[model samples]
Every structure is written in C-alpha cells, then in structure tokens.
Target: MMRRRLLYWITALGLGTLILASTGYAQTLSQQVLNLLARTNTWTADQTFDNLTITGVCTGCGGAGGGTVTSVAMTVAPAAIFDIGGTPIVGAGTLALSLDTQANNLAFMGPNGGGPSVPA
Candidate 1:
C-alpha cells in the first residue's frame, strides 16, 4: 500500500509539471512595448505587432551629447490604435518612424523611401 501511494503521488506530480510546462503564456501589450524599448541592438529584419501603447517619455535615449540613431522598421496591424505620447491614433498599413538624436531630428518614412534619413 505504501509503495502504491508513493507511485501515485509521483505520477500526479509529473503530470502537473508537464501540464504547466506545456502551457504557453502570451505577453501583454505593455510587456511587448517594454521589450521593444529594452532592445539595444539594431533590427535587420522587419517586425509586425498588434496594438501598441507607448507611455511615458524617454529622457536620454540618445546617450551623452545626443549622437545616437535608432532605426526600426515595424508594421502595425490594420485598424490598430497607436498611443504615442498619450495621443491615441488609428493607423492603416505600415507605420515607420526614425529618430536621429544627433541632429535632433525625426522623420516619418513612407514605403519606397531611400531608407531612413539618419546616417547608417
């Protein structure tokens, strides 16, 4: 009886762990934005995302002397709302924006443009 009970407990524990491990959890919109902002490397490929809510202001993303250029090519889904700087706006198709802090300039790039205005 003791051995049978121990086997049953072990089986139950194994099954529970398996179930938990197999379950997938999706990241929240806030988490996704946080992850994107945390990225330090340049993205070579394009990325697609659903609705994005960008809150708060970036104090010093351009580093010291403001000579940093960050390039991103991302497509927001159709009918998705983008909340930037507390302003909510609905956009269709791709939305690309490049920020060049070295020159203190920002540009909105459309499709078929000569890449971003920022120096590579």
Candidate 2:
C-alpha cells in the first residue's frame, strides 16, 4: 500500500508539471505594437492584424521619434475594438490606423465615415 501511494503521488506531480509546461502565453496588444515599433520606425506598406484589444495606457503605441518624423499605417480587418482607460471604441469592417509620433497623434479611418483622432 505504501509503495502504491508513492507511485500515485509521483504520477500526479508529473502530469501537473506537464500541463503547466504545455500552456502558452500570448503578448498583449500594446506589447505587440511596441515590438513592431522597436523593429522599424516606419511601416512603408500597409499592415493588417487580427482583432485586438488595448487595455491599459498604451505609451509609445504612436511610434517613436525624438525630433524627426515617424509614422505607421495599418489596418485591422474584420473587427477592431479598443478598450483603454475604461473607454471603449468599437468598429467593424477594416479599421485603418495612422500614427505620427512626431505630432503625438493617432488617426483612425474606419468604414463609412472617417474616424476620430486620438492623442498619444
């Protein structure tokens, strides 16, 4: 009986470790934007991404430029929802985004009428 209990405990511990190890963590929207900016200052061609949500304050999501001009243009297809600072901005279709770091500005051009300009 003692040997059987020890074996059961070992098996349980091994399974638990395996399950935890198999789990994966995904990066947040803000983190993804920052990573892209780190790679390049400007995005020449228009980029597209899946539905994303921005939670906390997103600093530097507007690209990065000290004194020079920097910009990024991308499209969020299907649907794009932004929940930041408790404010929710929801949109459908293709959501076009233009970011100018020098001006600390972010513009959104969605389907139908044009979108709003958000300060970064």
lDDT of 1 by residue, 1-120 (tens): 455432111101111111111223222334333445435233222222343222232222345575533443444433123322312334423444443233336454668555657767
Query: What lDDT does model 1 reach?
Result: 0.31
Tens-digit per-residue lDDT, 45-119, candidate 2: 222223222222222233655673243334343323431231132332333344323323645566777567798
Worst 10 residues of 1 by lDDT: 7-16
Best by TM-score: 2
Score each candidate by Cα lDDT: 0.31, 0.31
Worst 10-residue lDDT window for candidate 2 reads 7-16
Off by over 4 Å in 1: 1-22, 31-120
RMSD of each: 25.9, 26.7
